[model samples]
Target: MIKGAITGLGKMGISHAAILGAHPEVEMVAVCDASSLVLNAFNKFSSVKTYTDFEKMVESEKPEFVVIATPTKYHYPMVKYALERGVHVFCEKPFTLTASQGEELTELANQKGLVNQVGFHNHFIGTFRELKRLLSQNVLGEVFHFSGESYGPVVTKEKGGTWRSNPEEGGGCLYDYASHVINLIQEIIGRPEKIDGALLKSFYSKGVEDAVYSLLRLDNGLSGTLLVNWSDETYRKMSTSLTVQGKNGKIICDATEVKIYLKKAVPSEKLEKGWTIKYITDLALPVGFYLRGEEYSAQIDYFVDCISNGRKSEYNTFEQAAYTDKVIEMIVNHSKTN
Candidate 1:
């Protein structure tokens, strides 16, 4: 079994712990968190070791892989430490506070030849995977425009401030929310080479934005719009979707399903003219364990498989995530000018 450890027992971190604990290929060795309440719970129930200090846990456990789900500001140091120790790492996104930090870590990981994956779980979602496959086959010939959007009820009526309310801590709709959309667009569609316009708006939040609007141009010269808001009460939870328009057809995709429109028949895919819908059940591959979503387990599975098999993954790599961070910075800079 591949020995693994985790740090930060927040929502995402806890989820990772459960998933990794259940993984047939993984033997969870230890966990670390700053909260005594969380550590106490682990100590009471789990046989795994717990620590308040990350360095101590890593040094003592000597896990082959570690999952870091701490806040964005802490990602740089933790990821660097893991890489230097020759430990594979799976980190939660958005990658880092700055693009430069992401670049440096990416270089170090490459030099160390360690498996590194960012928790951009959307890439593992079946519908999006199908969307990428269809695009690769040129099913939507001569793609013209696209849009990426996400909305959630995270800060509907924000009063108190947490780390999420601070920009330096990777708060704000742009970093916390829109970064997902930006990464999807960068990887699946094309890299955003320029940020034409941007808007960071605050509704109930004091220090950070609750919404982000931006115009982007891809390296292929494809232009698109990005609209994300975490203040919307319409969505009980986060809802993200992507739309692509092309001469042949259009595609609308989300985590649950993908709706396709074809001007003419694509008999090979059994997708006729007009509209056709494919559900996640039909597209998602079965996994040994299930959690909040299959994509979560699927991404962890991929990370563990890559490390165990000594294979490098192209998906959700640090290099790709760093480019996403660069786009975030571009949007921020453009927002200032506007």
Candidate 2:
């Protein structure tokens, strides 16, 4: 069995720990968190060794892989700690506070020949996979432009000086919320070559931005734009959707479904071609202990598979996350300058 440890006991961290503990091929060797309460709570359900110090646990547990689910600022050091000790790492997104640190960790992961992943799990959802498949089949036929929106109620009121509202610690909706949508944008159209009319606005947060807007020119000929608003109370929950329009068809996606409409129907027997649709229900993927979706288990399964084979992930790699960071920086810089 592959040995693994998890650090941090936040919502996402707890979810990861549960999935790790349940994984048939993995032994949840240890867990680390700064809080005694967190440790005690986790220990109640798990008999795994627990430590308040991350390096202490790393030394004793000697985990084959480590999942870093702490806040954005802690990502670089924790990932560095695991990589330096020759451990594969799966880290939550916004890879680092800055593009430079992202580049450094990505390089270190590569040099160590370690499997590295960032927690951009939306792509693992089956609806997106179907959309990507259709895109590859030339269903879109020379895609011309795309636009996306990531909206939520995260910062609608006073945050009371949390790390997420502080810019220095990678706090803000840009990193915590927009990163997922930006990663999706890159997956659809690749990295943006130019950012135009960029705007980052702060609402309830101290100095951090709660909303972002910008137009983009991709490295390819495709054009794109994004609007990420986390302070909007209108959103009941988090919603991220992208609409890709092309010569022959258009693909639109929200959290759980993809809708495609073809101007000229493809000569396929299965698809109606006018508006073929796919839903999360269509995948019928098995869910584990988590209520979020199967994406977490799917991602974890993929990570363990990569570790077993001594390989890397094609999606959500450190390099790809770093690219997303670079784009984020561009937006930040643009917002600052203009």
Candidate 3:
């Protein structure tokens, strides 16, 4: 079994620890956090060793893999340290504070030939994979435009205190959530040739933007729009939907479900004055085509599979994560100038 260590014991970190601890192929050897209180609590639930210092945990446990679930600002240094020690790494989303840092780390990992995976779990969902397959099959012929959004209330309501509400700490809806949306778009339609965007800091007490919107132009003559915000008072909702206009058919996909509409009419169907709607279910859709799973668990399992089998990973690595960082930078910069 591969030995694993987790750093940080906050919500994301604790979740990663629990998932890795339960996996049969992994042994949760050690956990580290700056807070003794958090470390003590985790020690009570499992036999894994605990440490208040990450360096101590790494020195003592000597784990084959390390999960860096700390805040975004800490990711670069921590990942660099782990890579230097020859340990495989699986880090949380928004891999680093800047695209340059992300690129440096990606190069280091490649040089060391280490297994590194970033946490963009939405890509693993059956629905998304099927959507990719359909797009590749030209089911959504001649892609035109697409849009996506992820909105919710500020996770922490305090003033200038929450890490997510601070720009220095990589807080904001764009880096935290929109990164996923952007990554998905990149995968489906490829990278954008130019990006224009706007940001608003209306809701949060902090100066960080709570809402962001961007319009992108792809090299293939396709355009896309994205809106992500943390100011919504409604239920926590994340929807990644795309509508592709094609010659033969149109494909629409969202978190809830997927549908494909053929533009051509059937011979037996009568013409209608208004728009006609037809729904068809096909075997092409994967079974259990829903978005409900412990994403952290799936991410870790994929990383482990990559290490053990020498297989290529489907998840984003430092290179893709860095590209995402660059896109985000462009969006934020555009937002400022506009």
Highest lDDT: give the candidate number.
1
153-241, model 2: which lDDT tens digit per residue?
A: 88778667777778888888888888898888888656787888788888788888889888888888677788899998898998889
In model 3, which range of ten residues has the least summed lDDT? Answer: 282-291
Q: How accurate locally is residue 57 in candidate 3, as Cα lDDT from 0 to 100?
A: 84
After TM-score superposition, the amount by which residue 160's alpha carbon in candidate 2 deviates from its true location, in angstroms, is 2.4
* Model 3 lDDT per residue over 1-338, tens place: 99999997887788778777777788889998888888878778668888877877888889998999898999999999999999989898899988999999999998988999988877766556666777787754577777766777654354766687788788888888788888878777678668855565546546577777888876687887887776676846555566566776665665545666766543333422323332223322232212235344556677888888876665788888888888888887887788
Flag the better candidate by TM-score, 2 or 3.
2
Best by TM-score: 1
lDDT digits (tens) for residues 1-338 of candidate 1: 99999998999999999999999989999999999999999999989999999999889999999999998889999999999999999999999999999999999999999999999999999999999999998888899999999999998885968898998899888988899999999988999999898989999999899999999999999999999999999898999999999999999999998999999888888889999999999999678899989999999999999998899988899999999999999999898887
Show pairs that collide, candidate 2.
Answer: none
Q: What's the residue-level lDDT of 120 in candidate 2? A: 93
The C-alpha lDDT values of all candidates are: 0.94, 0.86, 0.75
Q: Point out the higher-scoring one by TM-score: 1 or 3.
A: 1
Residue 67 local lDDT, model 2: 95
